[model samples]
Target: MATLEDDEADIDPVKMILLDEEGEEKKLTTLDNGAAKPQMQKHYIRSIESTVAIRQLPSEGLSFQLWPAATTLVTLLDGYLSHLSESPLATTLTALSNGGDNGRKLKILELGSGTGLVGIAAAVTLGANVTVTDMPHVIPNLKFNVEANADVVARRGGTVDVAPLRWGEDDDMEVIGREFDLVLASDVVYHDHLYEPLIQTLRFLLNAGARGGEKKVFIMAHLRRWKKDSAFFKKARKLFDVEILHTDPPKEGSRIGVVVYAFVGKN
Candidate 1:
């Protein structure tokens, strides 16, 4: 099987137009050659008054870079932590917080944790124990971001653990376990070939038994790029109840923005 980097190398340079903090459209190009340099992007968690730094290696592959949807999810998490009742995640997070955990810190698992932005932000914002997982090759970068923000996470009484989790791998899933209160991901639904494996992994996490018999929730932030993306959701709905949690307004020259969805095991 071709590695993620190998697959990335086969594609032509991907041009992505993303919305900046000011909602301005910015163009970014991903090249196959090792021409892009590593850079650190800082995200401020207003709720904690601190910043989480992420390292991006664009030349490595998508797994080593930040995506626009990841930013949207992180922003929502920050707002949710700020006690903003109007936040898109307010209702869902509120229920998870009060769901008989007995005041214990929430345990979260993030899949396809590219750059670890969403997972790291969740750890800092929710004061939860978050495990960020991806392919083995991506663990190093994921750990770097986690360590870069360790102090901030510690200050919030949260912790982050990095692990390798290939979608559809039972052994990987077994090693990670299913004791988490929630699952998270962003920009993980792009590749058409990965759809089945991704959905299989979701089945293992959400449909399988969860801690305390509580149905686990999977929250994913995605930016639709192709019409075929609908197939993944169709397969997912067969095993889980899927709902749209939030939708970001489109940036200039775009028709759709990031959309956050929630998935849970069907009753």
Candidate 2:
């Protein structure tokens, strides 16, 4: 896992490079908005044969930047949609009928959707209707990225709606609703102070459909950077059955890579 400083180092680049379909690196054209130029990353979704462009406003804050774990989750989603037999997401998503032959498109809700990368990718890959949410202040950037990739998402028969959802806020949670088939997030568990709020949000979502005999799953991709991260998982385990779905190999200069986990309500 990369430390906060290491993640910050990634944002220092002045030129944002995007890959062409042929895999050649090309500089992304900067969009001047009377302020700092937004950093744009183009993630190629092979399943849809299209790319989703995500805009990051680094000047805003950490919530506006792309994170490592988000990229990992996007890759897994691409693999799953490609119907690759070896995709690590097969077991979990198949169980949820996310991209199965269920006839109905999967409905997903994403928490802490920084830059809206994973949510956008999921919509494109699975043709799922995804609601991407974040702090109220972050909603603008999320909407920007979602709109930027709207055509590509529509081509795949998917849609992405942006919303503001503060963690642990019951009113916000109620507004968003718990009718989703699955919940997704990446790089959400970090600050110790946020553990309880995130846990409360998870508890609210995971417990919603239990009485109706409907199983709602929360799949999170996390890169363990601090020893204290264990405390978040420990507390989460008390209410949800948490299980590892996949583990990415460590990236260069990192001791551990991103790990994907599935959390379901305890009976």
Tell me, by TM-score, which candidate is best: 1
lDDT of 1: 0.82
Q: What value of lDDT does candidate 2 attain over all alpha carbons?
A: 0.79
List residue ranges in candidate 2 displaced over 4 A: 1-36, 85-88, 98-102, 210-212
Total backbone collisions for each predicted model: 0, 0
lDDT accuracy of residue 74 in candidate 1: 87
Poorest lDDT segment (10 consecutive residues) of candidate 1: 3-12
Stretches of candidate 1 exceeding 4 Å from the true structure: 1-13, 17-34, 209-211
- Residue-level lDDT of model 2, residues 69-123, one tens digit each, is 8878888888887787475467778777734344888889999998899999989
